[model samples]
Target: MVDWSGGNDRGAVPKADAIWAGVARGETVEDPVYLRNRKIAEDWIGAFLEDELAAGRRVLAGFDFPFGYPTGFCAALTGQGDPLALWDWFAEQIDDAPDANNRFDLAGQINRDLVGGKGPFWANGLKRDVPGLPRRKDGYVNPFPERRLAEGQAKGAFTCWQMAGAGAVGSQVFMGLPVLSRLRRRFDAAVWPFEPLSAPIAIVEIWPSLTVGPAPSGTIKDAWQVAEIARQVAALSAETLTQILDVNAPEEGWIFGLGFERLLRGTPAPLRNDCFALPTGVHWTPVDEAMELLRSRLSPVTGQETVDTADALGRISAATSFARRANPPLPNTAVDGYGFAGGRPAGAQVLPLVQGRAAAGDAPGAVPAGQAIRVLTGAALPAGVDTVILQEDVTVRAGAIHFQGPIKAGANTRKAGEDVVAGAEILQAGRRMAAADLALLTATGVSQVRVRKRLKVGVLSTGDELVDAGQKAAPGQIFDANRPMLLAMIRQFGHVPIDLGRVGDDADALRARLDSAANKVDAIVTSGGASAGDEDHVSAVLDAAGAMALWRIAIKPGRPLALGMWQGVPVFGLPGNPVAAMVCTLIFARPALGLLAGADWEEPQGFDVPAAFDKRKKAGRREYLRARIRAGRAEVFASEGSGRISGLSWAEGLVELPEAAMQVSAGDVVRFIPFGSFGT
Candidate 1:
C-alpha cells in the first residue's frame, strides 16, 4: 500500500502534509519515502505498481483519502455515473504543477458549478480572494452530507467537506482522485468494486485513522500514523487481506478497518532484511486471495476413465484429445450436382453424363474425357474428380448435362481432412465437453473419450433452526433452502451430490458427520453456520480442529466462509443465511469445486448494461445486488439485505457494485452476471 499526500510541494524538505510513500511487502514496510511533488508521486506510483505486478506478485494498494465523493455528488457534478469515471474527470480537470497548483481555483470553479455562487465549500488557504469560493463556512447551503459515511463511522475523523479547515480533506479529494485516476488508467488496474476482481493491481481508498489510534505525548503524529499503518498492513495475513479486498464499496468506499476495528492490536510487523516475518494479525482474508490460495493448494481429482462418445457430452476431458480420423474421411460432394473432372469448361459446353452415379456412400466410375458424373450431396468423389456443380445450375438434355458459364474449379468439392485433420488436438484437458464437442468427435469417428471422474461431493445443511422444506417450520425455525439449492447446483454442474441432510448447531454432531463423510466424498460442502453469532458453531468447529482458514469476505448477503480439510477431504463452509450461502456457493465454492474436479477455472463472463435505478454505495467493499436486466438496463432487487432469500430468487443474476462511494443513476453501466452462466 502507498501513503498519499494532496498538499503542494514543501520546499526542498518533505513536510508532514506533503506526500510520503511507504511500501509493505509481507512483514517489511520500507521507510516512508518523501515525494516532494505530485508529478513525482504519480510517476513513482505507476512505476511501483507495474514493477510489483510484473514480478508476479499481487499488489493490494491503498491511497490515503476518499477515492470518491459522498453518494450522488460525483454523478451530479460530472454527469458520469461510474466512480472511476468521476476520478478520471477530476484528474483531467486539476492542474498540479509541482511548486504550485490550482486547488483553491478548482474549488471555486466546482462550488460555482455545483451550487452557483454561494457554496458548501469554504475557507480559502490561498492568499488571494477567489471569486465564488468562500473564506469560511457562512450561510452557504451544503449540497452534500457533512461527512462521508466512513468519516461518520470513525470518531474524530476529519471532515472531507471542508476545503481549508485544519482537518479538511477537500484538497485531498480534489488532488488525490486525479492521481488515482491516472494510476488506474495507466496501470489498467481495478478500482475496487467498480471492476471485476480479476486484475493484478487493486486500488483502495485508505484512511490513516482506520489503523492509527490516539498518539502518545511527544510523538510525531504524522510519522507515527504512517508507521502504524505500514505495520498493520504488513501484519495482514492472506486471510485478513482477502477479507479486506472482499469489502468493495465503489461509490461509498469503506474504511479499511470498519469491521475489524476491534480486532486491531498494535502488533507491529518489524522491518528486516529482504525476508519478512510471518504475516501477523491473520484474522481475515480477502475473497480473491483466498480463492487463489485455495486453488493453488487443491489437487484435482485423480480418477480417470474412458466414456463412450455418447456420454462425452457435458463431461470434462481428462487429457488433451485428438481426432480419430479426418472429417469427410474422403473427397465428397457438398451439393446435389454434377462432379466435373479435368475436362471442366470443355465438358461445360455439353458433356455426356456418366452411366454410374455417385450418391452417398457410392463411388461413381471416373469420368472419361468430355464427360460429367451426376452426384448428390455427401457422395464420394471418384478418381479424377475436381469439382461439383449444383444440379440447378446445369440443364440435362438428351443424356448430356450443360453447366452455367465460369464455374470456379473445385467449387462445392469437400476435400478429405478439410474440416479436421487426423491426430490434431480437438479438445483440451479440463474442458467440460459441450454437445457440439461430442457431435464433432462423433463426426471424426471417435467412439469413446477419456474424461475426468465425476466429483462425489457431500452437501450438508447446518443450523439447529433449519428444517427441511417438506416439513413445517417449528417456532424459531427456518426452512432448509440452502441444502436443496446447493445440491441441485452441484448436480447441474455434472457432479454427483451426496446429501448429508440437515445437521444441527451441535459442534460434536457436525464433526462426527464430517468424519463419516470424509472417505465417502471427494469434497464436502455445508450451507449455514459460518458467521459470527452465538449459534455460529461451524467456524468454531473448524477453528478447534485447526482444519481451515475461516473467511470473513467483504461482500453483502455473503461474508462468512470456512475452508478446511476434514480427515484429508477438503470441506467448504458457507454462510448460514440462505441468500449469502447461495452466493458464496456459486461465486467461490463452485469455481473451487470445479478445480478439484479437474476442470479449468470457469468464471461467468459479465455483460455491461445500464442500471435501471439509482444506487448509492461507499468504497472499500463489494456488494452483488440481486438484479435482472429489463429494457436493456440492470434493475436490482428492492432490498440488498443478506438474509433476503427472495432477492436471489427474484433476480435473474447479480449486479456487482464496485468498491467506491458512488450514487449510480439510471442507465449507468454495471457488470451483470446471469444465472444461466453459472451452470446451476
Candidate 2:
C-alpha cells in the first residue's frame, strides 16, 4: 500500500488515549479547538488507509479515535456491546453537525471506521475520523509565528504535542479509545508489540513471499515482459493493502500505515523491489528479416483481362470518357400551343379558320395563310411556322379560336439540339459511375462503357487451436473468427473476397495455401501465426514462398503485424486476437487494398469530443479505445479489457488517444472516430 501522513504538525495524528479520556470524562474542548484537532486526526487516518488500498488489501474492520468515542463510549456505558450499533450512533452524530466543515470533519471521523477509510475528508480513498477538526494541527495552532496565541505561551502547542506522542495514546484515555484499542488487538495477533504507541510511526506487513516470488536473479529478454509483471504486482497490492490499513492500523500510526504482499505464482520468479528494470540495448530486424525470407521464393505470373461494365457495378473498374449525340433531330414545341406564321398575327380581332392538329413526332409540313394549326407539347413545328400560341391563351368559339392578345415568335417552342449538341462530350475519363451518370449515358443512346476490373483478396486463417464455426470446440480448441471477419471487411472495401478456408499449424500446409492463393488473387490476408510462439508458422511459410515486410507500429491492439508480398501479391498477417486483428487490418491492409483498387481513399473522419470520465494510460503508445458518443461527448465502454469481445460490441465508435498524454481528465477533448468511418 502507498500510504502517507497528510498534516504538517505531528499532533494532527490522533492519540487514542487523549480522545478516550475526553469522551469518558465528558470533557469537551472549545468548539474551535475540537473542530481543528478532529480534522487533523481524520486527515492522517484517511491517508494511511488510502495507501493500504493502493497496495490491494481488503479491509475487514476499521476504527477511529475521538470521532467514534462519544457513541461507542456512551453505548459501552449504557451496556451495549454491539460494534455495529455503536457505529450507527456515531454516524448520526457526524451527520447532525451544524456546518459543512463540522459535518465533513465528523463524517471523515465516522467513515474511518465504517467504509474502510473512505469518505468526505480525504479524497476518494482516505477516511476522515472527525468532521469538526482542523485540516492541519499546525495551521490551527499557529496562525502566524510572529503573533503568538498568547504573550508567554508557546505557539507551537499542536506540533509539540503531536510529535511527542505521535504514535502513542496516554493511559488516561485507554478505555474509551476505540481506534487504538482495536489496533492493539490486531498487533497482538500479528505478534507486534502494542505498547510504545508514541513512536510517530505505522507498522505495515511486507508479504513479498505471498504476493510475489523472491526477486529474479537472472536477466529478462524484453522490457515489456518486465513492465507487465510490475503492472500485475501493483494491481494485487492495491486490493490487499487497502483493507489492512483501513481496518487494523492504530489511530496515531494510521497516517503512516502502508505495505504490500507480493507472491510469485509461476515457474519464473518475479522481480523484487517496488519496480522492474528491463535491458534497453536489445535490437530487432523484423522488417529486414521478413523481406529477406520472402525474396527467396519465386512468384507465379498471370495475364490480366477486362470485364464488361454491367458486371462491374459493385466492383472496382477503370473509367473512360465517351462522346455522343441525341437521335431524331427536329424542332418541336416545348409546350402545348398553336403554330402561326411569322412573329404575331396581324389585326388581332380577325378570326382564322382551324386547320389540322400537329402532335409530337408528327411529319413536318408547310403552313397555309389564314389557317391556324393546333399544336401539342413537344410536337414538331411546320416549316413555315415561326410562333406558337399556348392553348391557355386562346379560347375556342363556334369551332374556331378567338385570341385576346398577339403571340410572340418562337415562344414556348424548343429548338433542335438545345439540350445536347451533335457529337458533344458527355463524360470525362476515370470517373466512377453514379445514378445520374447511368441516366445520362442511356439518354445519349450509348450502350457500352469501359471500366477497370475489381481486385480479388484472398483470406486465410492458420492455427492448431482453431476450429470452423459449425464444429464443436475440443478441450483446448476455439472457433476461427478472423477469416469471416476479413471476408466481410474485404467485401466492404469493394473487393472480391476469395476465402482459402482454414489451414493447419504446419508450415508446409500454409506455404502451399499461400502459393495457390498468390496465383489467383491480387492480394492475400492471414490472421494469427504472426507472434513468436513455438508453433508460429506464418513467417516461416512466407519466407519459403515470397517476399515479406513487417512493421512494428507504435499503436496498441495491433502491434504484432506482418505486411509482405506473395508472388507479387501483397500479404498482410494480422495478430490472432480479434481486436488486434481488426485494428491492424484497418490501419494497414485497408489502405493498401484501396490503392490497388484505384480508389482515392483518405484518412477516416474524426471529430473532437469531451471525455466523460478520467482515464489512465502509459505514455509513448497510441491507444484507440472503443467508445460511444452521447450529447456530443465520447464515453468509453465500461469494460475496456482487450480480451473482452463485448467491449467492442457495445461501442459505437473509437476514441483516439495521442502518445504524449498519459492521463485523460473528465471534460478533456479527445478525437472520436465513429464506427461509420470504418464502413461498419
Cα lDDT of model 1 by residue, 81-190, tens digit: 78887888887888888768888888888888888857767778888999878898876767778777877877777777678868888888888888887777787787
lDDT (CA) per prediction: 0.76, 0.51
Worst 10-residue lDDT window, candidate 1: 269-278
- lDDT value for model 1: 0.76
- TM-score between model 1 and native: 0.58
Q: Pick by lDDT: which candidate is best?
A: 1
Which residues of candidate 2, in runs, are more than 4 Å off?
1-311, 326-432, 531-535, 543-546, 602-624, 627-636, 647-680
Report the C-alpha displacement of residue 494, candidate 1, in angstroms: 1.4
Off by over 4 Å in 1: 1-284, 343-348, 363-365
Worst lDDT 10-window in candidate 2 = 21-30
Candidate 2 per-residue C-alpha lDDT over 544-571 given as tens digits, one digit per residue, 9 for 90 to 100: 4544434555677666666565656667
